[model samples]
Target: GFADGTLRLGHLEVKASVLTHDAVPDGLTKLDNGDSTDGQAVYADTAGGQVRKVAVEAVLGSPQQIAPAGTAVVAADYRLGGTEERPEKSFVTVDATGIGRLSRTESRTNMMTGEVTETLTSSVLPGLPTGVKVTTVIMNTAADMVLVADNTGTLYRYDTHNFNAPVLAETLKPLPEGVTLTGIRFLIGEQSIVLTGSDGSVDVYFRLPRDNAKSSDGYTLIRAHQLEKHRGAVVAIDASQRGKMFVTADDTGEVWLRHSTSEQTLLKLKPADINGHYQAVALSPRENEIFAVTDGGQVYNWDIEADHPETTLKTIFGKVWYEGYPEPTYTWQSSSGTDAFEPKLSLVPLIFGTIKATVYSLLFAIPIALGAAIYTSEFVHPSVRAVVKPVMEMMASLPSVVLGFIAALILAPVVETWIAAVIISIAVVPTAWLISAFLWQLLPGPVALRYGGWPKFALMFAVLFLAANLSIAISPLFERLFFAGNFKAWANGSVGSSLAFTTLLILPAVVGILYFVGERVLPSQIYEIMRSPNRTIAGVADFVRWIITLMVGGIISWVLAGLLIGVGLDPRGGIVDTFVQRNTMIVGFAMGFAVIPIIYTIAEDALNSVPEHLRGASLGCGATQWQTAIRVILPTAMSGVFAAIMVGMGRAVGETMIVVMAAGNTPVMDWNIFNGLRALSANIAVELPEAVKGGTLYRMLFLAALSLFAITFIVNTLAEIVRQKFRKRAAQL
Candidate 1:
């Protein structure tokens, strides 16, 4: 098996040759190929259809071999391809001072006597301390990487095949309690370092991705996993052809099959069955047969056909049975918090947070922005509208980071203090605006004409002033009635779990039935009443409509409240307990502020662009200005309005800095406006830089961006479809 052989498949053929090198007489001297004496070339290989011999070393005199003070352990000659016209090769030797590279060599002959002699030279690469002895070295010449470990249990890595520099170098850190490192092994297919500790503990450190690592940087390990139940010092470790699954032996002669990532013991071999302290362990290249030799000269082969780890659907999508928890639960922990903590990477909560943040931002932004656009575009006098529209448009240019700063620092505190007042303003502001408009409509003709029309500035001031007074008056009433005179106490209260669960199941069905009845039955009956022109009949129809609307609204509120009943939660108290300083309220307001101007500018342009003749014709037909604006102008511009809204949403979804700074960035699943959330954009801003290049986290960040792209594509496509439909409908009109 050690000799060269030939293999064939169809017309293709492969020739395998066992390489060899020069052997000197000194016992301390080493050869590139072990136990081979009839070979001539030490660094010759057929690659890319050419022969390479290290470009021929320059030597003025006979080359001398390096004889170190201590016995050398391992020497490996690697065939490498490179940034050159052909492939090359390099040899490495590990001795007292650690990895000495065999850089150049020469052979000398005395021509007079026709005698020849061969000598090897070496170069001591950088990234190792002086006066240290290297116990083992691995050269990945194909990857241009070198790893060396010293007797003191310190391991170092170089970013070059020449072993000249360190990209990131440090001693093994954060070792477990009362354990000292005893040995190191290149494990998991030469991509990780396995440190064996005195207490039978093995720690696996995956190579960190270098910045320059290109496509498919391979797999990387972030945290170190300590193998379980290792009682004695681990004497040796070996991997199967499948790098993730491996076997380890302790000084006590017990052997265990384990996984490198999960660090779970798969199978065990007892000392009585294996017979001696295992000096070496190896897995067969072609089969699942493991061959182990003990110091007592006993050889044993373990046929492990089913060494693969077991998994099921529950381990992936369903609740996981963790080691210490009493019951299985959904979790999303990524790192090992402690040595005992399992790595859990669930996606449920994160997805929920992303949707929740986006929904809150849109809900807060749309109505206010659309209303403002409508009013400014239709009602305001041209002279005033020009000034107001530009002012609103300027808001789009304000940086999001500045908006986030203000939201987090200035606005959150203000809203938190006037929390009850803020809620009450929802009712008070509209009431005040309606009352002000009524009062203005009742103004005398002479006074209105003197004021250059309806006086929007003064009208808005009256509305705000009255709304502020009404909000302050009702705020205390809300506190006394619903919040027990303490808003914060109410905000923190939780609904009972059993009640929440019952409602979660029952309410949806009830609501669906109600919706079905409303859609199929109530509208048909209402349409009959709406066709009548009699005053009393119309009033009756309006009252019925309001009644249906109120019923639907109340049921929705009840269902939302029922959702608060969750596992171990108390649902008896104030619904407002969910509010927090940097919660969805802050993010919604900040992101909405950042988005509103975009919608306003585009919508205003669309609304204003409606032909003036349409307005004139509606007015001439005895229609009120508001009626004509809504029925004619808005309908004609509906396509543009929808496009405007979609564009605003796009900005909201992609807006990063404001949400990053204002949204507390907690990846929680709850949609309560009082709780903080994490968005995909904000998550990228927060996590992307901390991730290692080409690592899982790094690739996941790109996935998040791709998800954003997909969302934008879907939204835009839908917007276009709706816009086209509205355009057709308007053309018919």
Candidate 2:
């Protein structure tokens, strides 16, 4: 107990009679004076409106002389700043009575003599009622702002950067109608406040930015979470020195352990023999023990065993409103430079990223692998197939780390410069192949048969090469005409550019559907005439049909895109926003290169294993090789082809090194081809080494692994079920 400038702890007593000016100290705070060997304590002399400090030493054994640290003139409660290293050199004090006023004081101590000198500044804090007295003052770790509470249960926020001209930022009434405010303290990092009320309420408030027009400072206080209520008025509260845990004591003699971020009541303890109301409570420095003092001068202590109080199911899987954020969001920041940092471990973004990476890679790999397998199995000569199959199979042996390095260092920069050309080639290459095939069919019968073996394949390759180069040469002109000469800027958020880009992305599908419908809608007489034996007439008819289908499809796509944009449903704002250099496009291309060989090899083997008798029967029935392969062989081999694709998808889902190096490793949930992602595999690879064993991060990484395993197991199980159905259907043949 403290009285007459004397403080007693167990069997020890400290006297500072002269420094207190014979006034009894109402509040006391111990400070780390930056020396492990010496102790310093500050006392608030509210009656005299002064703060006093004394150096404590055990050897001296007698009452030590106390010195004046600073003065507040009408001091109520004083708290020092939150800098851990430089401890307690600056503090703020609130007025005990009168219009709301605060004192900001800084002290400098002599190293040798321990003499202290102070500089004091005072300011009137606005937003409080006219005649209310200030009761408690608390400052954040940054020390640029302070929260002052008045006797009327009103909280006022003051900007203390300019000490003489403090600005009142916000006014809040957070307590209930009949409840009085007893105490408030900042949790670790000072981004959250724990307030105790006279009606046994414990609530937490987070600093949020204001959305009102009257406030220009852009900040307000909000009640975010409330813990379990106490049985009586909560008289004393104290927070942990290291984490989000705190201890509170009520008049009913019950003490509760709680966490701020998780909003969990960890434990409750009631002293067995205590019968009086507790006046003060404290958490030990390491947070392993709790100490409470009753008004009858009795002290009770309890040992605690709480760990990882900040982690919970809601915190790991659901959206959380973290400190210093505007609203609740999915975030994955796991570590920081400061010890007071909060750990955010949401795994939603990583799972989304894993699925996204798999889908994009399969979109790039499946068509090319299957197309190559069909051509090799049905049309190529035995000698050429021997060479091509071996070479394609050898591609699977390349190292993924080497591919990631090439993609990140070489492909990303080149693609960013020619992305417009790359997109144009998607249409150009397929159209060039179609036109070349039509022209080749117009050749005389003997010449066509003579060159159809290896020469045909070589010519097709040359045409593809020429088409790619043509797109690259025309890229600058195309961008200038369609995207205002700056595709990146246009893609970011220009009006009509997003619609135009969307139209182009969906153009191929639209054109294919139109072609299919055109064939069905054509008159039978004209179709037979166009399919006549004359090569020149047939080729010209088909070319004209293709051109008409393309034009009509483009018009339909433009109208559809415009209608979507009119409804505020443009793709630009959601999954397809902002262009990033090293993004999903680059990672997909690199991982597809790693996945293609497995699919191609398996699919080609399946196609080659089809029965020779089926081919003979189709030919004997006057069916062409192309018709036989498409209608007969492909249906029989569908089950094997699908299994191969599923295997490739599994490879893409578990890929680590390639995505880690080339994907920019951002855990964002966007589906834009130009945005970066961080997959579960990559996240585990990158963060596991730094995670401490038996820590929250270490366990969370294991959970990520479990999620990945579940995804693969479920997909494979479904795939096997579908494969069996397909195989049963094929058996009837």
TM-score of each: 0.53, 0.86
lDDT of 1 by residue, 546-650 (tens): 456556745664566555454334343322236668888888898898888988888889899888898899999967677798889999999989999899888
Candidate 1 similarity to native, TM-score: 0.53
Q: Which candidate's lDDT is highest?
A: 2
**CA error at residue 627 for candidate 2, angstroms:** 3.9
**Residue-by-residue lDDT tens digits, candidate 2, 1-733:** 1122211112334654335445534443333542121125445333465545444444422221121223222333345663443334233444333444445455566788887655555566666666567667777655577887766788778776776677887777889777778888899888889998888899988877776724437877778887889989888999998888999999889999999888899989998899688989999989899999998989898999898887888888888878888778788889999878988889988999999999988999998899999999998887779988999999999899999999999999999989889878887898899889888867887898888878988998999999999999998987887677887877787633676777887788899888778778988876766676887787777777778888999999998878888889777767566888889989989999999999999989888888888888988896767779988888888889888998899999999999999999999888888899999999999999999999989999999999999999999999899989988888888
Which regions of candidate 2 deviate over 4 angstroms?
A: 1-90, 106-117, 213-216, 494-496, 616-626
Q: Give stretches of model 1 more than 4 Å off.
A: 1-348, 445-454, 494-577
Q: Model 1, residue 407: what's the lDDT?
A: 93
**Cα deviation of 486 in candidate 1 (Å)?**
1.8
C-alpha lDDT score of every prediction, in listed order:
0.63, 0.80
